[model samples]
Target chain A: MKGKLNLNFLFALALLATAAVLPLFLQRTSGGKYNMIVLTYAMIWAVAASSLNLVLGYTGQACLAHGAFVGIGAYSIAIMVERVGINYWLALPLTCLLTAFVGFLIGLPSFRTRGPYFAIVTLCFNVIVYATFENWTWLSGGYAGQPITLPAALSGRLARYYFVLAFLVITLLVVRQIVKSIVGASFLSILSNEGLSEAVGISAFRYKLLSFTVSCFFAGLAGALFATASGRVDSSITSYLHSFYVLIYVLIGGVATLAGPVLGAVGLYFLLDRIKGLGEFRYVGFGVLLILIIVFFPRGLVGGLNQLRDWARERRSARSPGEEVAG
Target chain B: MSFFVNQVIIGIQLGSQYMMMALGLTLIFGILDISHFAHGHIYMVGAYLLYIFSVLLGINYWLALPLCMAALALAGVLVERLVYRPLRGTPSINTFIAAIGLLLAIETLVRGIKKDAVRVPVPVDRSVSVLGMSLEVQRIIVILGALVILLLLQWFIQRTRLGIAIEAMAQDREGASLVGINVNRISALTFAIASALAGVAAVLMAPLGSITPEMGNLLILKAFVIVVIGGLGSIKGAIAGGYILGIIEALGVAYISSTYKDVFAFALLIIILAVKPTGLFGERTAS
Candidate 1:
C-alpha cells in the first residue's frame, strides 16, 4: 500500500512538473501568445470542474449552481477591484469566502430535497444568480460586462498561464486531501447510502453542507482566476448553460478521480476551440459528442482507461499461466 | 381593480401553456421517473412544425395544429425507443444526462436550421374588449384550447383501457406487468402522449411570441419550476402549480417589480423545497 501510494505521489509530482513548465514550452515552440491564453482558460475550467467533482462526482449531489458560484467569484473580484478598489489578489480569497457563504445559504434549503429535486434547486439558484448579475448593474456591471485589469505581475499571457496553473494544482491538491480525509469518507458513505448513513448517525445534512460550501469555495477561486485571466466578467458567466458545460467536463473526464476533471476540461475545451469556426453548428457537434460520451462512456475517459489497464493486466497474468503449462 | 384583473386574466393565459408542458412532464415522471429535460425542445419543434405546416405549406391553422401534435407524438415515441429505452434500469443520472444531451442537440439542430426567430402568422390579430379589458383573440383561443385538451386528456386517462394500463404502470410497474400489461408499450405510449401535450402547447403559444430555437431553454426552465412546485409526478398538482406560478409571476410583475418576474418562480421553488420537499401536492417518496 505504501509503495502504491508512493508511486501515485510520484506520478502526480511528474504531472505537476510538466504542467508548471508547459507555458514555457509553448512559448518557445508554438510561440503564439493565444495558445497560452487558451491553456490558462483551460486550467481555470479545470479548477472549476474539479470543484464540481467534489459534490456531483463524489458526494453524489448534482449541484448545477456551480456556474453561479464561479460567477460570484468573478463578480466579487470585479466589484472589489473596479468598484471598491481592492487589490486583485486580496479580492480572490474574499470572493471565495463570499461564495462559501452563498453556498451555505443555498445548501441549507437544498438539504430538504434530494436527487433531481436538489439538482433543480441548484438550477434555480443559477437562474437567480444570473438575474442578480444582470440587474444589479452596480455590482456586476450588468450586460455591458466589467473589464478586469490584471496586476502587472499577471498582465503577460505566460504569467497568467503559470498563475492559473498554480491555482489548478492547489485546487487539485486541496480536493484530493479532502477526498482522502475522514470527511471524504463520510461524503462517499452519504452518497452511496444516504438513508443508511443517516440512520447510523452520520448527519448527512452537515456533511452535505460542508461539501457544498467547500466545493463553492474552490469554484469561486477558479472564477476569480478566470476573471483575471480573461480580463472580463460578464452575466453569461452565471448562466445555467455554463454550469452544464462544467458538469459535462467533470463527467467526460471521469468523476471521482482527481485527474479526470483536469484532463476533461483541457481536452474538451481544445476540442471546442478547434471547431470554433463552425459557429452555432459547433454546438450541434458538441451536443452529439456529449450524448455519445454519456451513452458509451458513462464512467468517463479515465474510468474507461482504468478498465482497459486492468483487463490488460489480467490478460498478462492468464498468459503467464498458459506459458507455464506449456513449459 | 381592472388592472389587477387584467394581470390575473393574462396570468391564466400564460399559466395554461405552462400547464400543458407540465402535465406531460408529470405523466412521464410518473411512469419513468425521468425528468424528460428535452420536453421544452420538443415544444419548440412543435411550434416550428406549426410554422411549417401553416405558413410554409399553406395548410389551414386548425389542420396544421393537430398535425403538429401528431408529428411530435411520433417523434417522442422515437426518442423513447431509440434513446431512452436502452438506458432503462441504469442509474437515473445517466438518463438525466441523456435528456440534457438531447436538449442541447435538438436546440442546436433547430438553431442551425434557422438562426433567426420567426413570427407565427395567425388569422386573428385582433383583441376583443370584455369586462373593461382588451384581451387578444389568440390568447383566449390558447386558454380554451388548453382547457379542451386537458379535459380530453383527463377523460382519456380515467376511462380508456390503454390509459388505465398506463396509470396502473405508473402506480406499480411490476404489478402492472405481472397482470399482463405490456410495460414497453405503455412506456412508449406515456412518452408519446406526454410529448403530444407539449406539441399542443406549442401550437397554442406560437401566436403569442416569435418562435426561436433558444426560447425552449427558458421555456424548459419555467416548466421545470412548475413541475417542482406542483409536485414531480402529480397531475392535479401540475395544473394547480402552473396557474399558481403564472398568477404569481404576473402579479409580481404588475405590482412589485417587472425586472424580478423570473426570480419569483425560483424564490417560490426554494421556499417550497425548504418547507416541504415533496412539493405542495407531492405524496411520493421524493428521493
Candidate 2:
C-alpha cells in the first residue's frame, strides 16, 4: 500500500478531495456556460487519462495506442446505435468489450519489445488505426464526424454531465479496488523489477496483456461517453498525438497515483481551453508548463507539493525541543 | 520503363532527405540514449530559418544554407545543455516527455510568428535532361548535397579525435568518461553535429515543399518508421531503411492510392516489428 506514496501521497489525497467536490463547484459556475462545457470534456479526458494510468502508471507499460482504443469504443458504439439500432446502453458495454479485445491483440505484438521500442510499436499501431478510421469512410464516417444519438435518459447538458460523472465514479472505484488487490502488487513488482517479478512466477506477458485490456476497457468507456455526450465521433480522437496528450496528463500528474491523473487532466484541460483565449499561445503555454514541471518536479505536481509539505514538516520538527540546530 | 526509372529517382531523392534525418536521429539515440522526438521539429525550424535568411533578408541561397545550419547547431547545443542534459539518467520516459514538450513549444513558437505556411523559392530552378528524363536541377542539388554531407560525416566520425570520442561515448558512456572523455563536451558536440545534419535536410526539403510549423509531425513519424525499419543506432541500417521506405512509398503512390501511402509506412513498421522486435540490423542493448 505504501508503494509510491512516499513521493506524492498526501498531495494526491488532497487533490482527490478536490475532485470529489468538483461537480458541485462547477454547477455553481452556471454563468460560465462555456466553462461548464469545458468541464464536461475535461472530465471525459480525465476518465481517459485515468484508464491510461492503469496501464502506464500502475503496470509500467507505456501503451501509447490508448487513444485508438478510446476511438474504437467511440466508433463501435456510434455505429451500433445509429446504423444497427441497438440501445445506447447495450451498445456501450458491448463496444467497450470489443475495444478491450482489440487492445489484447495490439498488446501481443507490442509487448514483445521492451521500454522505448514498446512505445514506438504502440505508436505505430495508433497511427495505423488512425489511418483506417480516416480512409474507411463507411466504417468511421472519417472527418465528417460520425453522428452519435444518445438515449432520452441522458439528453441535455446537465444529464450528460451527471452521466459522465457517475461513470467516472465507477471507474475510480474499479481502479481503486484493482490497485488494492494482489494483481496490483504484481504490477508494481514488475515495474520495480520485471526480471525479479517474472522469475518469481508472475507471468509477465499475461499480466501485462491483462493490464492493457482492462485499461482499454476503461478507455473505451470514456470514448463511448465522449461520443454520445459530445454528439459526434471522429478519427481525430485516435491521432498519435492524442495519445501524447494522455501521456502529458499522466506524467504531469503523479505517476502511479490515482488522483494525480485526474488533477492533471482537469487542471491542464481547463488552463489551455478556457484561460488561454488566444488561439496560438495556448500550446506555447502548455509546452512551457510541461518542460518546467518535468524539469523541476519530475514526479509531477503532486510530487512537488509533497516536497513542499515535507519541507514544512521538517521545519516544524526541527523547531521542536528534540534536537539542537548546528547552523 | 522511363516512369519506373523516375519513381526510383524520386525514391532516391526522398531517401537522401530521410537518410540525413534518420542519421541524425540515430546518432542522438546512440550517444544520449534519448529518442529525441523533436528531431523533426528541429528540421522544421531549419526550413523556417532558411526562409528568414534567404527570402526575408535577401541573402543568397548558398549563404543562407550555411547560416541556417550554424544557427540550428547553436540551438541544438542550447537544447542539449539547458533542456535535455538535466534530464539525463532519469527514467527515459521523463526525457521522452520533455522532448515532446520541447517539440510542441518549438512548433507553437513558429506558428505564432509565421501564422501561414510559406515556401522558399528554389535556388536552382532550371530543368535538365538526364538519361531520357527531365530532371529539375534542384533535385540533383539535393542528392549531391546529401551525398557530400554523408561523406563528410563519415570522415568526421571515423577520422577525427572528437568524432572518435563521440563513437566511444556512444558505445559506452561510463567507460568513455572513465577513459578521460568529457561527457558534456561530447553531448554538446553530438547535438551540434546531429542538428546540423537536420539543418541540411531542411534546406534540401525546403525548396521541394511548403514550410509549415506542423510539417515536422509527419516528417518525424516517417523518420521514426525508417529508423525502426533499419534498426536503432545503426547508421547503415538507417540508410538502408530510408531508401527502402522511399522506394516503397514512391512505388505505392505511383501504383496504389496516394491517400493511403502513409498507411503503408505504418503497416511496414508493424510488420517488421512483429517479425523482428530488435529491428532488422539491430543488436539491441537490453536497457
TM-scores of chain B alone in all candidate structures, in the order given: 0.97, 0.97
**Candidate whose lDDT is highest:** 1
| Share of native interface contacts present in candidate 2 | 0.49
Tens digit of lDDT per residue, candidate 2, span A1-327?
254355455655565576556666667666655667777788888889999999888888777788888888888899999999999879989988999899988888778776766776788788888888888888878568789888888777777777887788789879988989999888888777889999999998888888899999999998898897778898888777778788888889877877778889988898877656688777886787788888888778766776787788688767884632431
DockQ of 1: 0.72
The top-ranked prediction according to DockQ is 1
TM-score (all chains, Cα) for each model: 0.96, 0.93
- Candidate 1: clashing pairs of residues: none
- Please report, in order, the local distance difference test score of every candidate based on alpha carbons: 0.86, 0.84
Candidate 2 clashes between residue pairs 3 or more apart in a chain or in different chains: none
Residue-wise lDDT of candidate 1 within B130-217, one digit each (tens)? 7788988998898898899999999999999998998899889999999999999998899899999999899888978899998887
